[model samples]
Target: MNDITVFPTIDDIMAAHQRIQPFIHRTPILTSEAINQIAGCEIYFKCENFQKVGAFKARGAANAVMKLTEEQKVNGVATHSSGNHAAALARAASVAGIKSYIVMPSNAPEIKKKAVAGYGGEIIECEPTLIARETTLKEVVARTGAVFIPPYDYLDVIEGQATCALEMWEEGIPFDTVMAPVGGGGLLSGTALTSKYISPKTNVIAGEPEGADDASRSFKAKELIPMVGPKTIADGLLTSLGKINFEIIMEYVDDILTVSEAEIIEAMRLVYERMKIIIEPSCAVPLAALLKNKERFKGQKVGIILSGGNVDLGKLPF
Candidate 1:
């Protein structure tokens, strides 16, 4: 079994909150009476979609960027991401007066690419394959001497991700279960760690797309599952979990669940129609899992981190 605890403790997570306080947004917690009725339970939705870069990635990227020294800052930073992380790094680096070098898939959403440019990030387009993205980022780092900021695989980033849980817990609401969609596992790993530390009795569950079910399989197999191409509509949750993230999640998390593409689409529509919130398919996985397995959470106070709200409304199939 792979056994390691790579996440920050409650004290450490709290400290990171203070460290990144000025740079990050404490996103809102939304409640809907109609939605709550449908679930047959109280639900708290942490709206990270309103965060900088239109996702919660801002917290980690901002924290990681600001922690660099003045000398290192001038050398700039590099990273490979689907969309949100690239935008977060670009915006955060702009705020810190540092250059951002982003390597992204050529097919990435234009709006996100435009946002990166708007924040003064230098974009290098690469093919969508994992190898191509890594190779392109490697060349950039070698050429520019810019440090690589991984999308979801650093201790600083994980600590930054934990702050959402800290902010949510401050509401004084006790939750029996907490769920967050796992992408590269930064956000969900942090959620699991925070829930374990602050509320030891609470269960932390990760909701992953069935097409990208590495986390779920790894958790059950008790080992790192090599990630393959992710085929799903939830573009934001396609990446594999990092080693550090997997370790922390394994130690602190209770379970990793999955949702189908159809379920994700249906849940996205439900969130929009009932809660009046626009969410991407990735963020809908948690809700989909809950509804798909309603008996487990029927009466429990559930806290779900809505990962993002960047879906193209015109693309909704329903």
Candidate 2:
């Protein structure tokens, strides 16, 4: 059994929030009566779309960058990401006055590439496979002697992510469950840790694309199952769950739910139409899962983390 207690505590999350306060956005929480009626539940949507870099990844990246040693900061930072985290880490490094090296999949959305460059990141493009991305990142780190801040899978990153849940808990509305889409599992694990410490009675749930449901599979099998070529329109969710993230989630998270691609598109459309806010497909997974199983959440108060808004407008599935 994994030692769940070894994970960062609520105090760590509080510290991260304080550290990144000046650099990050305290995004708002939105409530929609129409969405509430449709799901038959009270839902609080944390609008991370309005966040710095237009995603909650800013929270984790900023915290990580801020916690770096002077030596590490001087050496700069590097990471492999195809979406929000790439831009977020780049932006955070720029704000901290450090160089950022990014290894991005060549097939990654053009919008993401532009965003990373806009943040002053040096982009090294690799083939769209995980192997290629990792290999390219290794080369970049070797050449630049830069510290690699992974998109997820690090304690600092996870603790930083926990601040989102900590803020949600501070909102004073008691939630029966809190949900977020799982990709590499940083946000979900952080959310789980926060719920465990701050709202022990609250259930933590993860939503995953059915095509990339490794986290849900791992949860059911009681072991980590790394994904291989999982195909999903939710580009942000294509990565496998990290080992640390899986252990923490297995110990504290209540459930992992999977939703279809069509379901994701519809949920994204719902948010765009009803809330008048743009959300990426990954952000829609939690809502899709909830609506798909409305009976399970009827009459309950649920908190959801809208992970990002960095979608390619021209390539929208809807």
Candidate 2 has an lDDT of 0.92
- lDDT string for model 2 (31-63, tens) is 999999999999999988888999889999999
Residue 152 CA displacement from its true place in model 1, Å: 0.4
* 310: Cα error in model 1, Å: 1.1
Give the TM-score (vs. native) of candidate 1: 0.95
Alpha-carbon deviation at 71 in model 1, angstroms: 2.4
* Candidate 1 lDDT tens digits, 17-103: 888777777899998888788888888999998887778888888888988888889899999886788989988898888999999
Give the whole-model CA lDDT for all candidates, comma-separated. 0.87, 0.92
In TM-score terms, candidate 2 sits at: 0.96
C-alpha RMSD of candidate 2: 1.8
> Which predicted model would earn the best lDDT?
2
Off by over 4 Å in 2: 1-5
